[model samples]
Target: MARFCLPRDLYHGKGALAELKNLKGKKAMICVGGGSMKRFGFLQKAEEYLKEAGFEVQLYEGIEPDPSVETVMKGAAAMEAFQPDWIIAMGGGSPIDAAKAMWIKYE
Candidate 1:
């Protein structure tokens, strides 16, 4: 037998990232891919929103396309160290997918 768990909330669409400000938690870890999100200021925005939510945020950047097993392990380690109450992945599919795998290991 196997068990699976998914986050209870998901936000999407333009300005949806602002929804981070509504999350209730003491700490949050953000997982990202590449520099585009940073170059475009989305990363900073996420940080701001998370902070506004009163969460101490940590970032794990540069999860590559199709992320390797090593990357997943590194992310999981970071999560363990940070002990975040929540995890947020911002960017394209790679970072989000990697975060999902990392979250499983984190739990």
Candidate 2:
């Protein structure tokens, strides 16, 4: 049998960052690739938001486009080191999807 897991809270739409205020966590690991987040300036905003929510944010960036299996391993290793309670992956679909797989590997 296959198993599935869902987030306890899934908040979308506008200004979802406000929801972070309710998150209970001491550390957060943000996974990403390239400059899209930084180019749009969402990266800094997200980092600050997590910090404001009392989470120590550590970024695992440069995951790269298409993100090879090796990249996933490296990201997972970084995540292991960060030991974050919350995994925040922001970027295009590829990185998010890859990070999700990496997240599973971390667990």
Candidate 3:
């Protein structure tokens, strides 16, 4: 049988990213693409919130526009090493999609 898995909670809107502070986890791995999020300050804000929530945040930046298999492998390896309880993907669709694939690979 086919099965599905989804986040238990989903928050949106301008300050939605702030909700990261509420996540209960010891570690969080933030996946991002390029420097748009960083340039806009969203990336720093996300990290700060996660850190405020007592999570050890590790960043896996530069996920590229259309991530490659090698990139996925590297991200998976990083996830393995970091052993994060949560994976926070920021930026555009590329990073999110890459993170999703990395999530599957890590598991």
Candidate 4:
């Protein structure tokens, strides 16, 4: 049998990032790509919101476009070390895709 997993809750639209403050978890790992999220202040806001939610958050930044094997391994290793209860993929498709791969590797 094939198994599929999905987020229990999904939030979007204006101020959706702020929804991080409502997540219940002890730790969260944020996976992000290049500087766009940071340049736009979304990254910082996410960190702040997660903190406000009482999560010990760690950032794994600079997930490159398309992502490479080494990047995935590095991200998986970080996830292993952090042992986060939640993995938040921020930024564009690259980051989210990379995070999915990392999750598989981490598991």
- Find the candidate with the highest TM-score and give its number: 1
- What overall lDDT goes with each candidate model? 0.92, 0.82, 0.90, 0.91
Best by lDDT: 1
TM agreement with the true structure for every prediction: 0.94, 0.86, 0.91, 0.91
Model 4 lDDT, residue 27, Cα: 98
For candidate 3, lDDT tens digit of each residue in 1-107? 97658556545578899899889989999999999999999989999999999999999999999999999999999999999999988888898889889998898
Per-residue lDDT for 1-107 in model 2, tens only?
Answer: 97858456545557976667677989998888998888988888888888898999888888788888998998899889889899887777677877788888899
Clashes of 1: 0
Off by over 4 Å in 4: 1-10
The lDDT, on a scale of 0 to 1, for candidate 3 is: 0.90
Cα error, residue 7 of model 2, in Å, equals 4.1
Count the clashes in each prediction. 0, 0, 0, 0
Q: What TM-score number comes out for model 1?
A: 0.94
Question: RMSD of each candidate?
Answer: 1.1, 1.9, 1.6, 1.5
lDDT of 1 by residue, 1-107 (tens): 99897777667789798888888989999999999989999999999998988999999999999999999999999999999998999888899899999999999
User: Deviation in angstroms for 100 in model 2?
Assistant: 0.8
1-107 in candidate 4: lDDT tens per residue? 97868556555679899889988989999999999999999989999999999999999999999999999999999999999999999888899889889998888
Per-residue lDDT for 91 in model 3? 81
Q: Arrange candidates by lDDT, descending.
A: 1, 4, 3, 2
